[model samples]
Structure formats: structure tokens, C-alpha cells
Target: MVMLGDILAAARGSAGALERWLAHADPQLAQDTACAAKSVGLGIAGYARMAVADFSRFANEEDWATLVSSLRDSSDPGSTCLAAMVHWRLSAVGCRAHSIPQEAGAKDE
Candidate 1:
């Protein structure tokens, strides 16, 4: 069975590769991978948000902003919520950044 980690890794990698390909004007691969990235990013962000929601101590405005920025920068889809949650957590903690690693093993996904 494929683990969530595996899925996220694949999505992130695909998104990165697609971005690079698009930069080079590789239309075929870029188009295909871009679509895939959006799906994967959304899945990952949603999972993360749901998993961390109850942990109010870690959700704040700064965290949300950072998360939103990351999500916007991400090639994934529907990541805006994830970003908002991050900001909320950070604001709650009165910190500009979270102790958690934003890049945590997952690359793009």
C-alpha cells in the first residue's frame, strides 16, 4: 500500500519538475504535471490542516500568512485554507514562525 508520505513526495516532485519543464516551454509535460500538482498539493494541505486543527496553540496569523504564501507558491490546488490555518496558529503562539519545519521531509507535496 502507498503511504501518505509517498503520495506527497510524488506530488511535490512532480510539481517541481512541471515548473521546471514549463519554464523551458515543455508544453506537453508541463500541462500534464501542472494538473497533477494541483491535486496533490490540495490533498496534502487539506490533510495537514485537518490534522492540526485542534492544536489551537500552534495556529495563528503569522503561521497562516506563511502557510498561505507557501501554498500560493506551491503548484498544488486548494492550499489557501492550509495557509490560513498556518497563519492562525502562528498568531496564537505570538510567533513569526513555527518550530515545525515547513519543508519537513515533503518537497513540493
Candidate 2:
């Protein structure tokens, strides 16, 4: 989930989504991380003010999008109240976690 957040941050850029997200935030919560600048000092001062847009700059945009997409697709989906579908499809004889013998799992992927 942390990675997912990071990927989302990168896709959102330094101003677009952060400003929009802040617009709907509780006033105190928004004020708490209110800084628009980057800080790299010691102690609590470093985090006294922060912004959401500053994150996920660590990864290349294209690669990040692909990675996030892959992770999202890997999870099979279903609504608990409905007839099961994706979960059963993934558990089919030749798919996903069933593709290999998990009992004797391979290491060093």
C-alpha cells in the first residue's frame, strides 16, 4: 500500500492533486502539513510542514504507472454479496497462485 501511495503521488505531480485534495481536507489536518517547500533539517522542524505533491518524485512516471497497474490487476476481485467470480477464476487449475506448487515454494525470485 505504501508503494501504491508513492505511485499515486508521482502520477499526481507536485501541484495538481495535492491542492485539490487539500481543498476538501479538515482545516486542522490541512494546516498541520501545510508547507509548500521542501525541508531537510534536523528534528521535528523537518516535518513541521509538508505537502502531498512532494511525494513519488522518486520513480520515473512511465515505469511507476506500469508497476501500479500490474499490482492492481494481480488482485482478483469480488463483491461479498454477489456470486463469486474473479476469485474462482484465479483459483482455476492453471491460473495465478495455482500455476505452481506453493507447498514447496521457490525462493530467490
Candidate 3:
């Protein structure tokens, strides 16, 4: 059984990765990630600060959507990259937890 603590630890790791990615975000990668999400019908909103704790709740499709909406909507490249990273982590968590479907734009590339 997957422990909540393990999931949270992974989420925290993802957050750390986000910080690193933000420091040197690649425009091409960000653009590709956004396109991948859009191709799967996820709406991109505008930039808004995502709570650090949100990373710990990838237990459902709704949670995934919330993250995508907040992160992908950003006009800033760093935020876009962060969205991509968050999506990657959430997708992995969803697969491991079997909470989210594979068809929900979970593919990062």
C-alpha cells in the first residue's frame, strides 16, 4: 500500500524540481508541454500563484485540472515550465495511485 507520507515526499521533491526548473526554464520545453496539454483539451488560464501544498493532492482528476489551469495559464515561461513539471509529477502519481485516467492529457510529451 502506498503511504500518504510517501506521496507527500514525492510531491515535495516535485516542488523542489519546480524551483530548479524555474531558475532555468526552457522556452521550447515549456511550449511543448503547453501544446501537449492543449492538444488533449486542457484549458490554459493566466498566471496565478499556485499554493505549494497543492502538489500534495494529486489524488483525482479535478486536482490535476486545477494545477493545469493555474500553471499553464501563465504568460511567464517559468510558470509554464513549472506547470509542465507539475503535470509530469501529477501524472506519475496518478498512475501509481490509479486515481486519474491516462486519457486526461497525462502524457508529458
Task: Compare the candidates by lDDT and give the number of the best one.
Answer: 3
In model 2, the worst 10-residue window by lDDT is: 77-86
For model 2, the local distance difference test gives 0.30
Q: Residue 9: error of model 3 in Å?
A: 26
- Point out where model 3 deviates above 4 Å: 1-24, 46-54, 59-87, 90-93, 96-109
Which tens-of-lDDT digit does each residue in 13-105 have in candidate 1? Answer: 564532442335445434443343344454333333333453345444755566657665656423333334433432243332333323335
TM-score of every model versus the real structure: 0.25, 0.24, 0.28
- CA lDDT of each prediction against the hidden true structure: 0.41, 0.30, 0.42
What local lDDT score does residue 5 receive in model 2, on the 0 to 100 scale?
44
Model 2 clash pairs are: none
Overall local distance difference test of candidate 3: 0.42
Which residue segments of model 1 deviate by more than 4 Å? Answer: 1-50, 55-58, 78-109
For residue 98, model 1's alpha carbon misses the true position, in angstroms, by 15
Cα lDDT tens digits, model 3, 10-99, are 435564443344335554544544454355444222111222233444435766576567655666534553445445543454333433
Q: Which candidate has the top score in TM-score?
A: 3
Q: What are the candidates' C-alpha RMSDs?
A: 12.8, 17.0, 13.9
lDDT of 2 at 11: 30
lDDT for 20 (candidate 3): 40
